[model samples]
Target: MSRRLTLLVSAAALALIGTPAIAATPGAVSADFAQTSVWGGGYQGQYTVTNQSNHAISSWKVEFDLPAGTTVSSSWDATETVSGNHYTFTNKSYNGAVAAGATAAFGFVAGGSALPANCLLNGATCAGVVDTTPPSAPSNLKAGTVTTTGVALSWTGSTDNIGVTGYDVYRGTTKALTITGTSATVTGLAPSTPYTFTVKAHDLAGNQSAASNAITVTTAAGSGSGSTWPLKVAPYVDMGSWPTPVLTDTANASGLQNFTLAFVTGNGCKASWFNAYDPTTGWDRTDIDALRAQGGDVTISFGGEAGTELSGSCTDQTQIQQQYQAIITAYATSRLDFDIEGAAVVDHTSVDRRNAVLAKLQAANPGLQISYTLPVMPDGLTSDGTYIVQSAASHGVNVSLVNVMAMDYGQHDGIDMGVKAQQAAQATHDQLKVIYPSKTDAQLWGMVGVTPMLGVNDDSSTFSLANASSLATYANGKHLGELAFWEVTRDRNACNGSLTNCTNVTQQPYDFSKRFEAFTG
Candidate 1:
């Protein structure tokens, strides 16, 4: 017997002192045998042995009978001797002990070709003989709606002793995905196609449950068709300067679809501060509801030459992404415009960094519509000279539109000369169409500002409304998108002299009032 047997007997003697002592100690026996842990093709069972006599037992032997189909692979804490399906366990000196009220534990591994039942330990019955193995093979496996690009599948959760971990998703026979919690989004699927999906669950012990019911999904058809382009004309209106009477005008006297609020400033211009957020005052649910009532889209513009918080050095990609996300979430709008003309003052814009910012913003707000206000550069310059326009195309950024600031190039020294700015805007639109054929014509827009000034009367050396009208006519001829003006106040009689000869006026109504019908025609 092991030294532990002696200690158990001594301990038992002290506990049974007050009870009537039996002459002979009952043989130690155990019940409640169970497989605690299991692996592929192997398992371990544990049981407790207790003495039923008033006296201490020094040496104890346990005889266990394995159910059919099972064999004693190994034993521990005792000397095991086997005979057919029955086995005898002689306690080791260190463990051979059972007091009157004391119990001892012993365990062993059993191997079997198939799972066995009716197992017994020391000729006593066991309870809680659970199957620690994984769940049975999942049945009713079938595929649903198969698409060329993507497939969605769902299955029943696997049963297990502890609980099943998440599922492992498969595409065909190959393991394509692993979903821990639940549900997986298999993306990058081809359009107008079919695919199959399968899923299965696993337990903590790496035992996999049966596969779930298979499902399939087909991608929808492409949006573009034929040679006809999906051209959209979205004009930008300054919300800060919109006439309260016109904004509140339900009669639709001034035909406009959307109004944008300038919240940020750039190069000391008349633009508002970029980081200024006042949804309740600057904009609120009331404004959104009103715009919706008028069949208009309400958007906010960031970074103009002289807007607030826009003149600082370029912020890190993370800060920019955070700001965009917060603003979008706060305003509950998916449309965004980056008026990045000031980027020229900073370092040459990093395409990779810009892509990262766009990607981060997209991740935070899926299906976001992003637009860039790019400088209208003349032809024969490095593509980077156009910044956002070329970069977005090269990086595959999902830009909804490119609003070309056709008027601002004159504000810069290089290409500020007359006729050159208009020619630059025209060249930009032509190049963008050729370079990015996949982008819709609606994605290209012409920006026209209405300041109350005209070029030299006969010289045409200066910039004025006549030039803007010429550009608008050109844009219309090309079937390009609409044009945007700066502010209603600047274009009104307040800035321009009267509305009679509003041909080259700054106010949207005055400038476009007479020209609107002809331009749309």
Candidate 2:
């Protein structure tokens, strides 16, 4: 309806909501609390609230007191409110109803020392069957394939009371992932460096086993072009084709591991599942699932230059979050992206709602990764885009990447696209300093991403294949979070003169993708 193949327009990120629990009236509940990992003046911990009575508990609440200096920074599965040294956690809608003798587990990241005490549930002291015994330490902890910036891990499971809900994989003292399975792939590691890792098992009642046998592994040395973040190229196949993307048309088939499935959107203002590129059918999972089966993954992109953004599709915040959640649940990817532009960028009300929903989503799903893609000038983000970034940080949204669209800057001719892109990235890194003063320059760079339109951009400026190579080198040298292009389908030399579809220049196919793919971060 707007431009780019009648696609519509824009999208954004998320926030959270929760009602406070009534005065503590501990009814029929048992609660367990434990601290799992600690580092950088912060600690990771969990609280398990179980329905202990003979009947099911439809709703529950847990209140506890932290050590004098500690405070909850971010939490999941429950709406947490801190008052002085006391913290109150109420079950979210999804986890409120527990079956008789069932347990719902939730975890949090807290600042200061973690020493939580005086736990109560439903206004009553939560003293469950005291299981003071911790589970057996995880055994056979081993490293799988070691890459330039990551490693795959696996270990024998630990037995526990009420079953082992999850395992904590620690890189040094940092809790990398609270994985539900025995195996996990930990990313964002230094290349060509040796690191020690350990694992611990935890159960429904706040009990954690001793650490697993530590294993040290050296990451394979990376070449000049390398990154610790997940490397992804975009617009894999088109929606019209549905699943069988023409892979050979662009990048080489070997060593490609990730993609951002492009442009899933709500139908106009409906927020129903529809591919904006096609708009006639639901998501085509055939190709996506196949990629996953081959150990590759896709981060679904909602909102391109077109479509009704889910944030504006519904008036009610709950309904809007539900709409976004549907697609997330269906796809079940750990990562997601929102390409915010056009009306979505300036829609203040929707932006606020979206931010709240994202915070809630992050709290509900720890380890969920998010990225925001926005239009930018050669310098930096516009005020609106900066607001989006600030809002995400303020709402406690864990945005792993902030990708800037580094093309089409007012049709300025005779500009070096690579330099413009690099400047834009640097500007973004600078802007992030205000939001994350605690992060070093290098850390901020790692959180920044750049997405350039390959070949002839909409502004009719050419981004040569050489530009692509240089930009990839810059991104790798800076260790940026990601490097992407507008469309993988257009990574070819066949130009119909329409920058909307294919490259503008004549050259070898998949050249741009190959160059960008060299950046593994």
Candidate 3:
């Protein structure tokens, strides 16, 4: 429940190269630039030069453009070369030759203004005049022939008065390749990982064109997301509920590898676990650590039936967003469930605020997944529930999963609970058809999920062991997005009375959990 500050980078201002100072024959000696910044009395800089022969190059004016909050960083010894109006940069042979042509290193150490992050210069060639006009941007950059380890890329060529001589291909920020043709393949990438690429053309006069439109492409099969659950079946566990269940013990007992820890509420615009523990201050982390140690992961779910969800309690949207971000970062979780049931569903203002935060988070984090857990009827999502999805879509928040609370649907006579749950899912899918008419049926199925109450539900209908097994089968057959139950603690017990702690009518200790855990997709 606090504010955190992050510094981005001290980046590129200018790259002014000078002639090599030698008596006989002048050649390229050293192309070094000094970039300085002060962050908590610390300094760091990144340097990339084509070649340096240790010549005392003079008259090179090093400039600084410290753009705040730009990205990718840390604090190191400012490498303090000198102080005052001038700077002398001493180089460190940190990394070997980057790619085939560039020598990359870091320099800078002086007391100066604090700067934000990630600045990069394309490249330059020493020219007599340094021509002003660069070529037009490359057109229609596209990816083709993707493999497990590489992807082939091609783009339409650019033209200018001086004429285009070469093309520069970029993988993210780093220049990956330079070619005469418009097509090349970037290799040595990890499988199943997403990569961003762009293309820019340059003239013989050393003027680079603006980069073309970017494309994000993925390599085939396998995962790079370490220590997180890579599957689709993660059940909910009430962290603030009775019995205060141990996660590691639960995993060992039920053979479940993934769990969704629930209910990070708010206390005066600060995130709290039911107003009891501050999530950022290492609260209830021992179990989480132990669970991760065993190759299992937990999704940190915010906003439950608990009264003050962060958005509802806090009018300041930024404050609420920061708390949500902090919790996600603290857990290193890819999955986040917003349980927008119980009053919060109808709280449209809060819903919009939450959606805005989610949209930003998704855009900033490429791999982070977001889902909405809403109350559902056998017929489908209520009007309020549909509005939540509609608003999220309108705000540019891609809904990863729409999980339905398939429990407590009043009284039903003689109908199988599993069939009722399926009905709710089908109805919801049909509703999604109206909302996202462009999406295929299979695509809609992938967005649907159902979570039912185990053992005896609050209403007259009881979700029996048969119901759990049958529901899992249906979810697998449809290739659904996810399958979760209410709370693990309730399923762990089989006692009478005490609705919150135990499932009133059931057979084995964790029959329902085992059934749902069997879901692999």
Candidate 4:
């Protein structure tokens, strides 16, 4: 390849990617082409997808026409369905569920000048389906229960030609909330002030309907929390491994009532305990019931280092949501943890889907807490782990805590394991401050959780009993959200050096757990 050609490719790619496609019809799904690279014979290109509808879409397929002799060699992040020069790229299972007002994209390497014609997204024109009619106005708008700073409202939905996307709830002329549901709570109001609200329907092409029936309501005289998540001091227990974790016995010994059970992975769109025990059938109900009987509870973890997460198998958003909802209902637990380590942390499609699903779960079940236990280093979370948290925040998931698996730094060179865990927590707190700028210093610290591998790490360093004590003291001083280790069973056995059956150091059973049990915010 010519150096000049490389330079040309870079410039052309930048210019082409920067060019925007004018949407002829607003609020409609559209796909825009971008040339990412160039060569003498062919080039690499990409298409950015936009979902302008007020409601989310579960899947999308983009098809376009290329001139004779122009062909696609390969594609990624989307499944390709092609015949000759007509190329159709459909969303993969993980990336298919694009939220309302969200975007998805795919890329490909091709054999020509890098532009395509007759672009269509799910059989509609690339510019978006051109429909000019406005939706019917929402009917029977009425106020519901009022709080000190907010008031709830609901109304009958509207209809449209191209399909009604969502509704805009207006607080006297100013748009208060844009929501897909007919009901919503308008917050941030004076306690005793009366306000009038109306709603209007909107279509896919950005057409707004007439104002709905108005209603006035005065907020009550006291404050109440809105969509809150709980803080927990739960430690992890590997339920999938042998011995299967006698929860009550561990709880009895460690005096740690809260447990984060490991891994409820997918059994083909269904929830399974590491693909062995079906969670819905209450396979482990006896242990959970006994644990709960002792005034303790468990947080069902959804993903781990092994097998596939639900989104990897359940392509339908509704089915996946049901799968998760069933587990929550079955366990009757308020907390959920997503252990995203290994390759799952960097998988953006599943990350986004998980965040979206958790957001909905939180909405449906208020005070439902969610956390991500991610891979970390002494310095901080890797770039991929940071992106995982960023995606959750962007998707409106209420993150109760971000637990860093502070283990397995591959170098042996005289590292202070305790100091490394503290540094990682501090660094993660700082990153979170950037992601959530409005949160206070105290709030950011409260969102931190540090989990170091006990006994001997899988690397050159070791986490001794003293290190656990030091980390717990540090966590308590900062009011960190949680303190946990890799597995509860390992803390019981006496063994040496990086074995799952035992902590690599000499210690009595429950020594590590007892140290971390006192951690509280």
Winner by lDDT: 4
Best by TM-score: 3
Off by over 4 Å in 2: 1-228, 232-255, 268-282
Q: What TM-score, computed on C-alpha atoms, does each candidate reach?
A: 0.44, 0.56, 0.58, 0.57
The lDDT values for all models are: 0.48, 0.69, 0.68, 0.76
Candidates 1 and 4: which is better by TM-score? Answer: 4
What is the per-residue lDDT of model 1 for residues 1-521, given as tens digits with 9 covering 90 to 100? 33222222243553432221112123323343444555566655555665443434444565656667778776777888878776777776556546656767677777863333443433333221222477554444443222223333434456666445446777667776654434333434556665667777764334676666665556554334211111132344444443432443421554554445554443232223333334312234344434443445445566555443332334466655555555564444555666664544243444456566776676665445566665554452235535555666566566655565544333444433335545655566667676667656544432222121232221223345555566556556654433454443333432434322222324444454233324441
- Global local distance difference test of model 4: 0.76
lDDT of 1: 0.48
lDDT, residue 12, candidate 1: 51
| Residue 219 shift from truth in candidate 1, angstroms | 16
Compared with the true structure, the alpha-carbon lDDT of candidate 3 equals: 0.68
Question: Candidate 2 — what's its lDDT?
Answer: 0.69
Q: Give lDDT tens digits, candidate 2, residues 1-521.
A: 11112111222210111111222223335776655555678856666776654545555678888787788888877888878888899987578768767788777878886567777766656664444567889998887555565666778889875456568889999887765567666655667789899999875444789999999989877543332245444434344334446433222453455677666666644453344333221245444444543455567777667665777666676776666665555454556788889988988787777788888886665446678999898889999999998988888787878999998897575678888999999999999998889877776887888988878888778788889899888887888888877766676435666665678787666667778877855
Task: For each of the candidates, give the backbone clash count.
Answer: 38, 20, 5, 1
Q: Tens digit of lDDT per residue, candidate 3, span 182-283?
A: 666565566678999999987644578999999999976632221122347778988887567899888898888678888888787888887777786446
Q: What order do candidates take by lDDT, descending?
A: 4, 2, 3, 1
For candidate 1, the TM-score is 0.44
